[model samples]
Target chain A: MGELRRYFDDIELGEEYESPGRTVTEADIVIFAGLSGDYNVLHTDAEIMKQSIFGERIAHGLLGLAIQAGLFTRATQAYATLAFVGLRWKFKGPIKIGDTIRLRAKVIGKKETPKPDRGLVTVQRSVLNQRGEVVQEGETDLMIERRPRP
Target chain B: MTGSYFEDVPLEHVEETPGLTITSAHVAIYLGLTRELAADGGAVPDVLPLCFTTGLGWRVPKPPLVVLAFMGLDWQVLRSVRVGDTIMSRSRVVTKRPMRDAGVVVEEREVVDQRGEVVQRGRFTYLVAKRTKETRA
Candidate 1:
């Protein structure tokens, strides 16, 4: 079992965590298409995409969001994450293949849930490309288990 | 396949999609793509990944070939979607605004499980190309 890094009470509001960068690849797009059943030509049809405004295939916006979630898992050792409650996000820019992206997340708010054993932690996240441009930004609310009391 | 032109879409038009069952294989494929390692020895959580929920939006019926670009997505998972649950999706055109050669279409999509419970909902915005009389001819 992975070690629990932080409990609900341990997270400090406004604290930020930066993730290691990973490059988006053609394989990532194809795999995501297969998994999501999103065969949108903009993502799969290079020839057609070249005629579009982007002039080339772009990663699915949701793929970028999913990558950010993966990066958050690696950056913050939140082994106690119970579930993702919700998210409010905007896709600011296109994530082209080969563009390396990373996440900068900060704790924005916290609240106790009706369930005494768990609480909600809201994190504001910004997904930046290698050029430091924000490709996506949003807030995610996560339910986390509280630390066990003696 | 010719997609619906911006002028063709009607506001508040709703479409329902066939039911899709979320199986362990589907979850495994998604988990593999994201590389989200489960801490409990690959035990699938009662709550699915948020992105997966968004992914289901793609399965919803959309205006044919008119999908030009994915502008944005705002979503919320209202309830847990457990593995082996059969879910169906429906979308309604909420708003449409014209741009240069295309227009943006905002759709409110909802995913309901077999039990008739709302599992997820979101607004998906897309840029759909405007069909000209020349193209229609």
Candidate 2:
């Protein structure tokens, strides 16, 4: 009953994290593609994907970003936040269905904004494959409400 | 792309559409590759964070499974998923409105587990480009 109490104070900038990785399936890719309407052949068709440099159907890169959202906001109770200032993404490798992945995040910086009611938080997010290779990366800027302002 | 404009979307729209199904392996692989960023060496592997993956699975065309943000999202937990389960996802146009810059395609997604039980549902929206004037059909 005590695993969920860490906060911004518990972390440091540039620190890297690694989570228990899991595998992906082709069905997963199609569902995501079908649901999102992203018909990118690289993620849907194995034969077509095989022709790509990656040689297999890869999971949607957004999976990494969604992982960050799922982890960060809940762990820190950050969702009560005001606004997400920005986000950036990087796809390092192809994530084939059935390929396991580890979700991770690191605090790159934190700052108190000029507004008395809010502050700024920045994080570096990433996803790695079972091979320990980093596949996806991202950066986030969030506005944290700290107090009431006139 | 559905090319839904940023005007208005209705619930019936998604209801008319079909949901999608995926696998636990894919969910896990996405997290495995993403774990490198979580600082805990990773994010939630069991329950909490998972809702997001389940949620993302339904949302479609997100930033990157590895590094993007929800942009704007809303997810409902109807049930939970397991390792071998097939995750089903469905979405609909919830909102559409014009943007001064790029047009938007707000959407909603619902997810179900292999047992046909709903795992999660979201009342969120997605965006798309009205990049150039699309020809009227």
Candidate 3:
């Protein structure tokens, strides 16, 4: 486990964190489909997708990104995160159902802001399947609060 | 150019949807799925609106793209989305590159609140299926 209540001052460039694994389930895909209203055959039609190249239903691309958000917060040092300001992401491969995925993130860049109480940090994030293949990868920018001065 | 198929989508075409109010129920389903609790419990989860950007694509009046796959996204959150805020998405087709049987369509997507302030903006690249001889028939 990492430090709790981590502040901007505590983040170090090049530091990495890995999250606990989570298996993508049928419910996850179905729930995401309803939530997003994206009933693409690739995700919803099993028989139809069975004839496609993938041969099975795959999770929504944004669903994986949403899961990555949860895994990031769970794995990283508990920062006083303020806002998720930016994301540069790519869908490199398909994430099929029953695939267990985890996040591997590294602090790639950091910058100070005009405000004294907060700063920005950029983390290179990767969502890897159980086989260690990177299904999705990107960089996310987060605004974090600074440590309080007594 | 009248249809929404890969080949039919014209560049610079803009599609906008009516406002959809963000309710606590939507946030609850999202939070239940992601299990991500905002650092400030009272605040909406940062990624909720980002996910909604894709969902809002369904609300457009124009026919949907015959998309084969989602390629990627380059997104920036310009402002926070509060509970009860009504947000709408505006997507403009920026580029279209044809492959063999499919095409890559890139669109500049924006989520604006009721006040018409941009809450989030992004570039979405989608792999769309072009109408072939079989599909055209």
Candidate 4:
């Protein structure tokens, strides 16, 4: 883990964090396909893909986002994480197998929930491929607990 | 199955998907692929991953060979979903816009638990190819 347990108070707006990168592989796609049950031809049917514009198979957009989430969790140990509130994301480009990707995340906004012990943190996440191009970008909100009363 | 073309999608009728019972095995497989460890020793993670819900939505019925590409997503997790929860999904076209050879189709989707409470909702936009002149005629 990159950071110790992060509480609501520990998060600072505008602060950024970069995550380690991972390469997408064929096996990853197959496993994700089974887990998600998304057998879209674009993701599964190689023969059909040959005639498509992309000219090859592409990873599912959600799979890329899910991997980004894993990278976030691995980069920070937020013991106070309450729940994943929401997200608005765009898939800027197709991520083919063998493309390496990482996350550039920053705390963009925050708000206090009605519950005194918890708050919402909004993060701007950019998923970048090996070539430094942003393949996906989004903002995700997470509900986190404040530090326990000392 | 032939995917829905831009002109084939019905914007009003919400399509429902078969219900699926979330299991520990599903959670484990997802965690393994993502290399994430459960925060606790429960069968499912404390908060179910949003991708799981999105996956359920993808099972909704659609026309064949018409979906060009997935464009974007906007989603919200309204409540926590735990292991053994039976969930179903419904989707309806929210918007559609035409382009030169393709069109954009946006669908509003909701995932509901056995209690019939919506646990997740989102909009999925896709670029769908229009029927060729031959097919349209």
DockQ of each: 0.52, 0.05, 0.74, 0.61
Query: If ranked by TM-score, best first, what sequence of candidates would result?
Result: 3, 4, 1, 2
Model 3 vs. true fold: TM:
0.94
- Which ranges in model 1 have alpha carbons more than 4 Å from their true place? A1-3, B39-62
The 10 consecutive residues of candidate 4 chain B with the worst lDDT sum are B41-50
Give me the TM-scores of chain B across the candidates.
0.81, 0.54, 0.91, 0.83
Worst 10 residues of 4 chain A by lDDT: A73-82
For candidate 2, lDDT tens digit of each residue in A1-150? 122433334444676554554566676566555434555444655675565456766676655445445545433433324445555555666677677766677778878777766667677776778787877776766565554434
* Candidate 1 C-alpha lDDT tens digits along B44-85: 533244345445555555535467667777777777776777
The full ranking of all candidates by lDDT, starting with the best, is: 3, 4, 1, 2
- List runs of model 3 lying over 4 Å from the truth: A1-3, B1-3
TM-score of 4: 0.92
- lDDT by residue (A43-143, candidate 4, tens digit) is 89898898999998999888898888888876665547887788999999989999999999999998998999999999999999999999999999989
State the C-alpha lDDT per candidate: 0.78, 0.51, 0.86, 0.81
Clash pairs, model 3 backbone = none
lDDT assessment of candidate 1? 0.78
Residue A130 C-alpha lDDT in model 2: 76
Q: List, residue by residue over B1-137, the lDDT tens digit for candidate 2.
A: 23332332344453422333444454555454433222222222332323334444424443222211124443434443444555556656655565674444555666655566666555543333343365232
Using DockQ, give the best candidate's number. 3
Q: For candidate 1, write residues A23-131 as lDDT tens digits.
A: 9999999988877666778789899788777889999888888788778877877747777777888888899999999999999998998998989999999999999
